[model samples]
Target: MTQQHLEPPVAAGLPTPVPGRAAKPSMRELILQAAAVLFYAQGIRAVSADKIITKVGITKVTFYRHFPGKDDLVVAYLERRAQSERDAIEGARRSSPGDPAGALRLIAEGIGVESCAPGFRGCPFINAAAEYADAGHPVREVVASHRRWFKATIEQILHEIGVADVSGVADQLVILRDGAMVGGHLGHRGDPQVVARSLVNAGRAVIEYSQAPD
Candidate 1:
């Protein structure tokens, strides 16, 4: 019998001898990922490329090799997140299998997960914007585009559900999601899923009430 081991994807892309990290990620990927975590955890201005290289356990040269600079890495990180959000929302829609309301509930519930993080810091985009509010950095533009897409997707779902005010439902859900993220970040120690469930329930109640025959 022959046994096989697999070399990772990034392994074929970069020089060996770099240590740590799970996948032996390429310099560009490493820089993107480190920026993702640090900027997500501590805001972009608060974290630097130096910190990313140090956290990645890679040389400064390795950092520069992948990303021209931190701004480039920031854009890459948000691009990755934008892709992920699209995938997750698409997955949630599939999970409900023709029930947009169910999918919306699932989406909200996941975002407010109490165990997701300590000091959660809300959405990565919101956190980054708080830091670069004046700079209009690459990160800000990426975040802005992502938020628009997300809200639009939610609106599409509401429209499919026959809601009269699709935009209103989407905007309301966005507020609930963001508010729960902040609540979970601050005073809430209990299961954020409970708060998440309540958000969905409230929306459902409004839908039912509006549709009730007079």
Candidate 2:
């Protein structure tokens, strides 16, 4: 007797399987991509697993198979954002090797460009944290971790630039960055270039002030 392997039933609107292999995205990737867009465009709390399933054309079974629940998916979404940020910062550092100020400027310029883009929303981590107020939640942990990394990165840069108060300067720069992101999304009065220039100038002043002779 031959063993029969039964394939899962395909839902309507979802891609049908081919004889050999299906030319479709992996269920996990599809869920993550769809959720990322929805969470960013529409707040995280506003987007539900059912909505994601509808958007991705996947069944509940598929979503659950990839993620245990909504919280799991949210964590994955944050992790993706964190990885992207780390990569961008690393690229800036590599592009301006040994020039901490230049690297910082690159990051600020990138943020400004993103803030001015069409359909621009505020920072993903900030948005997520607002919705998931529980600091102990996985989503909040990811946000906090990213923030810590960002602050530490700035401190290191300030220290390299010979700043006297690395900790204070880093804190000021982080605050300025948060403000820029909020202003870019809400204010929208000035050109993105103007916003970018202002951020760079402010960051530079922080470093300069720290370096000034007391």
Candidate 3:
């Protein structure tokens, strides 16, 4: 997705300490919050340490004190994003206790809904992977770890639902999800309801296919 289409950085209008209040944000928190926004809104390579420092209104020394380098900050950014995704999935699962397929539907529905949000960009993990080409890079490692967790989570869900080919179905579902995110960002011709319905249908097909008798 184009930069213009992406959501504005979260750092904008960040809270400042009020007079006579002991609730000032720590230097580390400021740096992380700002970096997360900039990295997600702008490309990671495009955001330099100086830019982050300026955004956080901190000195170079303080920035380094929190993150020794840009790579560290990038890793932190992905970790934060990963945690958010995990929480979202967990929330969906909790909402439909004992119903794996229903939980998966909730997640698929979330992806469709999120894609339509104003200033929606594509998947952050995919975007980060594009920026960091080296598989050995710390940023790529973070992406890989997240992907592994995600795929495993999907597999576990399918397994719980008694899918015969859990691994294959999980892989197919991941492909569908990634495509939906990209297609939605590109304004592919469907309304959110249509998109969500399509996702649920495709996911149901996979589960049902596995249930078919040989």
The per-model lDDT (C-alpha) reads 0.70, 0.80, 0.81
Give the runs in model 2 whose Cα sits over 4 Å from its true position.
1-24, 187-189
Where does the lowest 10-residue lDDT sum fall in candidate 2? 1-10
Winner of 1 and 3 under TM-score: 3
Candidate 1 Cα misplacement greater than 4 A, ranges: 1-24, 114-119, 206-214
lDDT (10s digit) by residue, model 2, range 19-54: 898656557767877887888877888888999999
TM-score against native, each model? 0.80, 0.86, 0.86
Off by over 4 Å in 3: 1-24
Candidate of highest lDDT: 3
Q: Is candidate 1 or candidate 2 better by TM-score?
A: 2
